[model samples]
Target: MQYLNGKFQIGYSIRKNDEEFVYNNGFLYSYSDDPEGINEWHNYKGKKVSSLVDPYEIFFYEPADVVPGKVKITASPFWTVTKRGDIHFMMNNVEGSDKAKNVHSYKKASDSEFTHTTEFPGGELRSVGNDLYLISLENDRPVIRKAEGGTNDWTVM
Candidate 1:
C-alpha cells in the first residue's frame, strides 16, 4: 500500500493461484490471471478512515499503530531567538478541546516551519514544516512524507 496527497493507492495482480496487491499514491489496482478468480479493489481518498471500517478492528495496515493513546496532558514553555537575536517566549494552547489543554506552547522559525513542545499527558517536541508549530494529540500522528516524494529532508528528534 502507498499514500500520497492524503490519499491511499492500492494495486493487486493474480497469476495462476497466486494473487498480488499493490498500492501507490492513492490509486488501487488489482489483477487476476486466474480465469475464475475474482478481482477486487477500492479507492479510499478524501474519505475518513473511520468511514470504511470499525476503528477497533485490527487490520494488517492499522492506522492506530502509528498513533498514540490517551495520556495526561501537560504544557511546555516556548522560547525563541530569531536570527536577529531577538528573544521571545510564551505558552500557547488550543482553546475548547481537551487535547488542546495538553499543549504547552509553540515556537515559530519560518513561514512553513516551527517547533511545538508539550509535557502534559505526554512529552514530545515536534518540528512543524519550515516555520510554524502546533500541539499534537496523543492519537494524532503525522504521516511525515508523501509516497511519490523521494524522501523527507526533515529529521525526527
Candidate 2:
C-alpha cells in the first residue's frame, strides 16, 4: 500500500505459468497463452482433431431482452421452470421489514409478461421436480407449505 498525492493505493503481484501479464493505467490484466483457443480440440491420441463445422457454427447465439417494460423487479426473485415450460417466480418486495410479503407469479413460455397471484407471508421458495414448496417463519418457527400447481395457493405440509 502506498499513499500517493492524497489517496491510498494498494498493489498486488501474481505469478502463473503460460500467462501474459500487463499493467496499464493503474490496472493489471493477465491472459492465457491460447486466449482464443485456435488449437483447442484434441483426439484420444492427443492429436489435433478437425470437425466439419466450426465452433461458432456449432454454437450460435442471439441476444434478446427478456424482461417486460411494465414489470419492476425490485428484489431477488426465487424462480423455477416447470416441466411444462411455465416459469414461476416468488419475490418479496418489502425492503428491511419484518412483515414482508412473498408475492407469487407465473408466466407461460409463450407469454411476454407474468401474471400476479395471491401474496403470502415472507418465505423462501424451493421447487422439487414438478412440485413447488415454501419455507416460512411462523411465530419464529419454520413452517412449510407446498404450492397447488403453479399458483400461490399452498397446502401446509
Candidate 3:
C-alpha cells in the first residue's frame, strides 16, 4: 500500500501472460505476475440481473398527433416496424417459406389490416416519402415491390 496525490492507493491482481500491463491517461500500472497466465484483459463494472421483453407479443404505439394509445401483437415480428409518415409497416412470420405475409395496420385507430402475400423473415420494410415498400428473398431470389397502400389499405406493391 502506498499514498499518492494525498490519496491512499491499493492494488489487487491475478497472474496473466498475454496481458502485459495497463496504462491510463497519465498513470502506468503494473499488476502482480502470477504463475498462471491471463490471455485477455477485461474491464468489469459489476454483476447485474435484468429481464428481456419477448419480440413476439411486442407492443406498438400510435403517433401522438393521430392517436394516443398502444397496441400489442402476439405475432413473431420478422424485422421491425418501418414508419412512413403517419403509417407503420412490417412483415409477419408464418409456418413455411411461403406462409409468412406482409402487414401494415398500426397507424391510426381507423386503420385496417392490410396483408399482401406470403412473405418470409430476413425481409426489410421501407418507404419513400408517403409510399411504403417491402423487399425480401423468396425462393432463393431477391424480390423488390412497392407497398400499395397509404394510411389504411395495403396491398402487394
Candidate 4:
C-alpha cells in the first residue's frame, strides 16, 4: 500500500492490505479489483452526488466486526443526514446476505466515539419538519414511526 499524505497511490492492491475504504467527512473512495470494475471517488449530498466536496453530508458510514448485544451495531447502505445536521444510518445484528437490517441514528463525538441517538427495526428514513421517521414492513403491512426528539431521544410510536 502506497499513500501520498494518507491516501492510497496508484498500483496499490487492496487484496494485499486493509486500506481505509472511506475517510474524510463524507467522501467515499473505493477500489475494486474486478476486471470490469473501476476505481472511483465521489461525495454525496442530499439526493445529489458530485466529484467535488458537496455542501452537506448525506451519510457517514463506518464498518466493523459484529459485537454481540451492546457493541453490535452497523451502518449499512440506507443512510442519510437529517436537516438538523445529525448523522443517521442503519445496521443489523449480524452480517450476510439475508440478515435483518435496522435503522439507527448516531452522533460522532470523535472518530472512535459513536453514540446512538435512536434505533428501530425498519427499512428507510425520511424527515418532515425536524422530526425523524422510520418505515418498515411488518406482517406485510407498512409501518411508520417517528422519533420524539433529537438524537438519542425518542418515544416509540
lDDT of each: 0.25, 0.42, 0.31, 0.38
Model 1's TM-score against the true structure? 0.18
Q: Which scores better on lDDT, 2 or 3?
A: 2
Alpha carbon deviation, residue 48, candidate 1 (Å)? 56
Global CA lDDT computed for model 1: 0.25
lDDT, candidate 2, residue 72?
28
Candidate of highest lDDT = 2
> For candidate 4, lDDT tens digit of each residue in 1-157?
1232222222101111123222111212221232333344322222323332333322333332222222223343344444443444444343324343343545432223245422457566655545677777789988877773245454447
Residue runs of model 2 more than 4 Å from their true location after superposition: 1-75, 95-100, 108-113
Q: What C-alpha lDDT, on a 0 to 100 scale, does residue 153 get in candidate 2?
A: 69
RMSD of each: 18.3, 18.3, 21.6, 12.2
**Per-model TM-score on C-alpha atoms:** 0.18, 0.44, 0.32, 0.43
User: Quick one: best TM-score, which candidate?
Assistant: 2
- Per-residue alpha-carbon lDDT of candidate 2 for residues 65-124, written as tens digits (9 for 90 to 100): 122222222444455555544456555542221332445566554555456644566477
**Model 4 residue 114 lDDT score:** 43
Tens digits of per-residue lDDT, candidate 3, 13-130, equal 2222233211210111111122222322111111111211221112232111121222222243322222232334343432222332334333421344332323224356655545
Runs in model 1 deviating more than 4 A are 1-74, 93-139, 143-157
Candidate 1 residue 59 C-alpha distance from true site, Å: 52
Give the runs in model 4 whose Cα sits over 4 Å from its true position: 1-61, 67-76, 92-105, 108-113, 117-119, 152-157
Clashes per candidate, residues 3 or more apart or on different chains: 29, 0, 5, 1
